[model samples]
Target: MNRSSYPYVKTPPIFRCLIKKQQQATEELTYKPRRRRRRKVNNSDFYWWGFPIGTGGYVIIRFLLTIDWDFGSFIIFMGAVAIALISGYLLIRSYYRDFKSEPPPEYIVNKEIRKKAIDAKNKIRKRYLSRPLKDKVKKLLKGKVRTLEPLTPSATVGVSEKQFLAVLQKYFGQRVNFPNGVFSIIGTTFEYTPDIVYQDSYTGLTIDIEIDEPYAGKSKEPHHCNDNDKDRNRDDFFLKRNWVVVRFAEEQVVKYPVACAYYLSKVIYQLSGIRYEVPAEKLPSIPTWDSEESTSMARLLHRETYLKEHGLWQIRIS
Candidate 1:
C-alpha cells in the first residue's frame, strides 16, 4: 500500500494540537509589535529637554553676534531654526500624548492588566502615606535633629541620657520628672518605668515619654522580639489612662538632645499653657560636633572629656 495511494493520512490528535498552538504563536509573534509598557512622564523630563533647548538659545545668540553673513542668509538660517524648534516641540508633545493615552478597552479589561492597575495604585498610596515617617527617620539619621539649643539649633546635640535630660532641665527647670509605676494591660499588671514623665503644673495634663535603648533590664541584655510586645502593652496602658504617649529611640535622645528638648518644651507649653525659657548666660558651651559623624564613637569620648574638664557635664539627668 503506497502512502500516496492513501488520499487522507490521519495525523495524531496530539500532533495536530501542537501544530495549531505553534501556528497561533507564530501569528502572535509576527503580528504584534514588541512594545514596552509606557512609563509616566515626570518633572525630570522637562529638565532633560530644557537643558538642550537652553543651550541652543545661547548657541543661536552667539551665532547671530559672531556670524558675518548677509541678511538673506540670516533670514534663511532663522527660518530653518524656527522649523527645527517647531518640529521638536511637536515631537515631544506627541510622545507625551502617546504615553499618557489610556490603553484600549480590551487591554484594560484583561484581568492581569486590571490587577496590575490595582497594585500600582496601592503601591503609590503606600508610598504617599509613608513619606512623612520616612522623612522623619531620614532627619534623625542625618544628625540634623533640630535641637532647641541656640548653639546648634539646626543640628544634633548630646550623646548620653544624662546629657539629654540635663539639656531638658537646663531649660524647663523642675517640670521634667521620672516615675516608676504600675499599669494594666489586658487585665494584667506590669511595672512601667517611664524614661521621662512631664505633668503640667497648671493643667494637670500628663505626658509619658519613653526612650528605648538597644538593651533591656539592669543586666543590659540585648532586646528580644518579645520586648516590643511588652513596650506596646505599656503604651496601651498609658493611653487607656488618658495620658499622652511619646516614644523616642535612644539614638534620637543622644543625637538630637537639643531638638528633643525643644520638642518636649513645645509639648509642655502646649499642655500647660506656660512658657519656659533657658537662661542666656547659663547656656552650656557647645563643642564643635560635626553633624556628619555620630557622637557615640570617639567623638563622644572627646565631648565627655571636654564637658568634664570644663565642669559642664552633669552626672544626673535632673
Candidate 2:
C-alpha cells in the first residue's frame, strides 16, 4: 500500500524497441485526407490564341522568306485563295442541295386539305346513325328508351364494315340485307340476334351472316372468351335448326370487299340453287361515293373494259 513498496516487472529492451517501432509504423500508415485532382480546363482562350497566332506566324514567315513578289510567292498565295474559294463553293452547294431535297410547301397544304375533307365526310356520316326500328319500338312501348353508342365509320376503307355492305348492295341490289335487319334465333327460354340475315325470296333459302372484329380471335381476354363461347353456342343452335350460317372476318370484309362480294355471291347462288351473272363494274367499291361505288358511268365502262380483257370473273364456292 506504501509508495514504491511493490516490485514492477520490466520488458526486454529489444521487445520495447520493437513495440515502439510498431506504434510508429502504425501512426505513419494512418489515413490522411486525399487532395482532389485538378480537372483539365477546356477553355476557348487556347483555341483563339493558337489559331490567330499560328496563321499570323505562317504569313510572316512566308513574307520574310520571299524577298520580292516572285512566281513562287504568287503561286502559294493563289493556292490558298483557291482552296478557300473551293471550300465556300462546296458549303453553298451542300446548303442548296438540302433545301431542294425537302418537299414543297404545297405538299403540306394538300395533305391538310385532304385531312379536312375526311373530317367533313365523317361528320356527315354521323347524321345517318338513326336506328329506325329501335327508336320506333322504344316510342311504342313508351318505356325507358336506351341509347347505344353510334358505330362511327372509319376514315379508311379497311377499317369499316359499312363499306363492305355497300359493295354487296351494288351487285345484289334488294337481295342484300342491311341496316335494320337482324336474325332472331328463338329458344324456349331465350333468343339470339345476329347482325345480318339474307333470305332469297325465290328459293326460300336463308343465310345468316356474322361479321366479327379482329380481336375476336384473341382468346386471352375474359369478355372475349365469354363472347366466343356464346357465339359458338348460337351457331350450334342455328345449325341444329337447319339454318345456313356464314361467318366473315371484319378485316376480310374491309380490305377485300370486291373479292369478298364475289365469293358471297357465288355461295348464295349455290345455297339458294339459283344461278346469276354479276358484272365486275356493277360490284360496289368501298368509299361508296367511289363516283356512287367509285359512279354508275365509270363502273359501267370499267365493267365493259374488264369483260373485254379478262372475259369473266368466276369462282366455285362449295
Candidate 3:
C-alpha cells in the first residue's frame, strides 16, 4: 500500500528520542534515596566543657608528679603554683570570717544616721512645745484622735474610747453618775456593758452613749445577727421605759467627733432644757451611708435600756 494514500503517518526520529529520554528520567527519580534532616546541637551542652577540662588537668598534674626524676625547673614551677593556691585559699577564708563576724555596713551607717535624725526630730518637737498655751491647747484638741484598738470580742476598750469618755465628763460635769469619777456605764445583769450613761437632775431625762466601729460590711442575715439582735432587744427594753439612746461610730468619733458631740449635746438640751452650741468648724459632715439613721436610733434605744435597768434614771443631777 502506498503510505501517502493512508491518513495515519509514522513518528519522526527526534520525537521517538524525546519519549525515551522522558521514561529514563522518571525511572531514575523513582529509585532515588530521600534526604534526611540533621538534628541541631543544644547550647546547654556547653556546661560539659568544665568536667572534661577539670578531669584532664587533674590527670596530667598527677602523672607529672609521679615521674621518678623531676626536672629542677619543673619542681620550682610546681612549688610556685602550690604556694599561689594556698595563698588564694587563705585570703578567701579571711574574707568569709570578716563578713560573718562584723556588723553589716548598712547597720553601722544606719546607727550614725539615726543619731543625727533623732537630734533633728528633738529640735522640731521643742519648737512646737515652746508655743503659747492657747495654741498648745488648740493643737491637742484639734483633729480627731483615733486610738488603734483590737476589736476581738475579749479586748478591752481603747485609749481613744477612754479619751472620749473623759471629754463627755468634762462637758457634762456632775450631771451624770460616775462612781469612779470617770463617766462609765455599768450593769450587772448582762455579760456585756454599755459604754456610758447620763441622767438629768430635774427632768428625769436618761441618755446612753455607745462608741461603735465601722460596720465592716458584715452581712445582716447570719454573720452579725447575734450582736445586732442583742442590740435590738436592749433598745426595745429602754424604749418601753422612756429613755433616750445615742450611738456614735468610731469613724464619726475620729473623723467628725465634733459633729457627733454636737448631736449628743442637742439631745441633752432637748431632754434637760439646757442649751450649748457646738463649734461649727469642728463638726464633721453628716455621713452618707444608708445605715447612719438606723445606727443613731439603735444607739439611743440601747442606752435607754441600760439606764432604766440600773436605776440610773432615779439619780438627781442638779
Query: Which candidate ranks first by lDDT, i.e. highest?
Result: 1
Cα lDDT, model 2, residue 83: 55
- Residues 1-318 of candidate 2 have per-residue lDDT tens digits of 111211111222322343353334333222232333333434653464445545655665676677688888777766655554555565445445634565558656766776777667555444323323223222322422111123432222222345566777787776665424223434553435544545554443445566544231123112112224565576665554444566664434544567666666666553333555654433232221212322342434432333234322231100
How big is the positional error of residue 269 in model 3, measured in Å on the Cα after superposition?
1.9
Instruction: Tell me the TM-score of each prediction against the true structure.
Output: 0.34, 0.33, 0.33
Candidate 1: list runs displaced more than 4 Å.
1-160, 180-189, 217-227, 278-318
State the weakest 10-residue window (summed lDDT) of model 1: 1-10
Q: Per-residue lDDT for 1-318 in model 3, tens only? A: 122211111222322343353334334212222232233334533344434445545654765676565686567556655655655565455445544566657766776776777667566655644544333323332332211122223324532455566666666666643222231124642333345666654444455565544232222212112234555555444443444456565445544555566667765553334665655434433332235544553445533343345443344211
Residue runs of model 3 more than 4 Å from their true location after superposition: 1-159, 176-192, 215-227, 281-318
Candidate with best TM-score: 1
For candidate 1, write residues 187-235 as lDDT tens digits: 5443344566566444444566666444432333343122246655655
Total colliding residue pairs, candidate 2: 3
- State how far residue 208 of model 3 sits from its true place (Å): 0.7
Regions of model 2 farther than 4 Å from truth: 1-159, 179-190, 216-228, 278-318
Native-structure RMSD, model 1: 26.9
Query: 96 in model 2: Cα distance from truth in Å?
Result: 99
